[model samples]
Target chain A: MSEEQNKQTLVAQETITAEVNSSDTIMDVFVRGARKGWKVAIDNIIPNVLMAYVCIKVLNVTGVLAWFGTAFAPVMAIWGLPGQAIMVILGALMSMGGAVGVAMSLFNDGTLNGTHISILMPAIYLLGSKIQYLGRLLGTAGVPGKHYPVLLGISFVNAAIAMFVMKIIAP
Target chain B: MEELKRKAVKVPISGYIALMIALVIFSGLMAKVGGGWTMLDFDTLNGKFGLMKSATASFMGQGGSGARDGFLFALSLAPGVMLALGLMEIVEHYGGLKAAQRLLTPILRPILGIPGICCVALVSSLQSTDAGAGMTKALRENKDITGNELLIFTAFQFTAGGIIGNYLASGSALFSYMTVPISVPLAVMLVMKLFGANMMRLYCKMFVQEEK
Candidate 1:
């Protein structure tokens, strides 16, 4: 009993020490976090969104976006999304922000709407950025190479399921 | 890795309060409230840009395309991203995440077939993909989890990896267009993540030959 009490006391002391060590005021902490947010916005969001717009422009100029909309229309109909929405899914595989960029571009051009955006939102993140994450996440975690396909498959399945759920829930 | 463990500090009551407030902010519930309460909402605080001569368009204007349009559009999104992350940071510093870790621990085994020890990595993964993956590697190297458990946890992190950060950051772009509240889709992502993890658990159980 005494040993347990001693351990508790040690833990209590450690907590107090941690509190003392973090001397920044609340406002300071908030600003520090906000700064990190600004960096992400500048570093990742802007460039990626810009790239997505350009890609969409190229696809638009080449008439590929129209072609894709016709080709994928049947498949995307399952999610109540237009055929061009496939581009958002494809973009998500590479980068989540980029997928958002595509979705935004499509929305701007009248190919999608508020409801379509709502449906695609969860699906975008559910399988978002898998190409980069295949190495950054799966490889780093040391999952056997053999199971990579299965992991990716599972994410795709999850994304598919999320779209169905979003379709039901989205207004 | 050890330092990440240090982050599992005792979550004070303030941490719980901070987390609740964070949820309320991101939940979009307060977005409709009148008066000063709007300050508590994300979109309300994000605010709108001053209109150009058209009155209908923001600074980006219309009939634009390609890189320049994308650049201006993305620039328009910058403030929302910054506000979201800044608030996320405040939540982290207040131990909201640690409190989340605490709340998530007990349900870990039931939900993901992983141990409570993984709660830290799970929460970390919700914020940053690299941090979660790095911690998972450490978890495996330390032999804190079995091979199958690692796969399941990785599967969870794999789908919807960095949920909060990615959603609040990039997903913020769609916030205005959504017919539902912001938190609804977030909830959907989280649910799908768990569902995906369980699928992995079943796969590991049925297919893989256990070495142990």
Candidate 2:
């Protein structure tokens, strides 16, 4: 072989050797790992899905929800959101996934329309985080010092501003 | 002596267990007063799909509507997930993240008024929420952080993703103009810069900022 061809052969050999060393039991290891990962995912998915179900489907707490909507009237006015907008924001505060669930519901019901969407998307984007869990989980586990209030407050305020802005530009 | 004591501290297992017990008791009492919990409306999945179909049809002829939906969906996740992957590729290829970190060192020190080394926690948090989880796991494993540091990081991490990856892809089209060559990343960073400064000021007032 010419020098160039010889160099190519050397490189190919190096590649084959690296592949062999890195993935010696590639199929077996990959299969076992995938099985283990799926097992954990399945285990965790049950409680989470169940809790989400309970919060959204079962909690027919419209009385409280209406209160939330009314309280958010000023905030809604900021974004020019209808009173109904607060319901979705309330949904989001409860759970981002849940709020998405609620927003999707409202949009489906024809409660949101037009440039109204652009206004709401930013709010949904902002106020909607997996935040409530942070309070329960982080306050319990984030750190030892009494910074929970500070952390939680900043996150909420940040999300709140995003939502308020969205309420403003909704046509 | 005070500094040494702070470095050596750990939450006693007994104390942590006691706290858990207290929480459980508190939760039980709250539950008893509040009654049972309920489910989310996720089973209304049909409604979600129906909305999508209708929105698509309504905005069918409208210019930029389809593009807006597609763009917003990607914007919501791209900065955190796709960008992280893109960054990993760049780091693997050019070894630039280290350089970036090194360049950021002088600014991170006084910018947030935290230790220069602690900037990695902030950066990692901005990139991915789970990445910050990994950082916390490492810190716990290594016993590197004190209780106070954990609180500080918790506050920081919760607020980190807002400016960077989270807001990068979604709704800034209004600001960026369609198909222009302007810098979206810079725009997102600027938002973070503005918000992050206010956030740090707010947090400092709420908690004691330890001087390094």
Candidate 3:
């Protein structure tokens, strides 16, 4: 590990050990969790969401988003969503927060509404962030490289099925 | 692994109650209740920002696009993220997660085709991806699970890995716009995780050969 990361790890270890040894009140625990949440919101969610918004803006300016809608509409229609919903799915492959960003941008643009958001929600996470998880999750678990495709395929199937289920159940 | 097998934490009855409270908060069932019961809901407690100008517009304003718009939008989600995690931390502190692990042990074998020994890693997987992955590696190195079983468990974790954390933290962005309750999508993703794991199990049964 880099020296910086090593230091951070040491500090984190110290914090964990200290916290465990002490009998903290419930409020202290909540504040600690909230602090972690704030870190996540600032470091991960905000940046990804910003990038997604810029990406959608670029797609809109070039009219590529419209073409995507037109092309994917027929397929996306099966789930009762518009053609534009494909961007959300594509964004989800990389990051869950990005997918939400794309979906929210589309919602703001009047391309999708609450029902569409509802329909797309589970699929966003079901296939959420798999591109990164390939290394962090499957690779670390020592899942053989050969089975990667099968695992990926199952996630895709899960996402597709989830959208269908969401369509039926979304009000 | 021998060293890792330490004594289990004692889960008090309060831990189970905290688990139930966690469920009810995220489930959005309490979102519609009247009077003091509304305190139990997520959205109700997260509340809303003051309107900026027009009746329709809030702090984000309207018709804005691009990164600037995204920044404001994300900022709007900050409080919800903080609140969700704060409550999650409280639940976890009171042994809620341990309570969940105990509950999930009996169901893991039937639902995911994995041994009960995986219960700890499985629960951790829902909150943090790296921790779950590291624990799974330990499980494999210790030979607690077979190769096929590892594949199945990894399949379960790979899709929607970090379910609760990601959902409550990142997924909170869409909570306001969702037609259903906040927890419905989470519920769906979890069920689908189970289904995907089973598919992997079926694939192993049919195609992947077992080593002698």
Highest-DockQ candidate = 3
Compared with the true structure, the alpha-carbon lDDT of candidate 3 equals 0.86
Residues A1-171, model 2: lDDT tens digits: 456334433432221121223343434433443453334233432232234334433333435545655776786766666666776655545544334444433444455554444555444444445365364336433454355556556665655565454344332
TM-score of chain A of 2: 0.51
The weakest ten consecutive residues by lDDT in model 2 chain A span A11-20
TM-score of 1: 0.93
lDDT of 3 by residue, A32-111 (tens): 88898899989998999999999999999999999999999999999999999999999999999999999999999899
**i-RMSD per candidate, Å:** 5.5, 13.0, 3.3
- Residue-level lDDT of model 3, residues B58-177, one tens digit each, is 979889999999999988888989999999888877668778877888888888889987887788788888777877876776688988899999999998999998999888889989
DockQ for all models, in order? 0.43, 0.04, 0.56
Q: lDDT per residue, candidate 2, B74-177, as tens digits?
A: 23322223322332222212223233344455785355544455444444455445545444434543456544455545555554333333333222222222
Pairs in clash, predicted candidate 3:
none
Model 1 lDDT per residue over A1-171, tens place: 356334433432332223423678877876776788788888999899999999999999999999999999999999999999999999999899999999999999899999999999998998899999999889878999998999999999989998999999987
The CA lDDT of each predicted structure is 0.86, 0.41, 0.86
Deviating ranges (above 4 Å) for candidate 1: A1-23, B1-9
**RMSD, each candidate, Å?**
5.7, 18.5, 3.0
Error of 1 at B194 (Å): 0.2
Q: Which scores higher on lDDT, 1 or 2?
A: 1
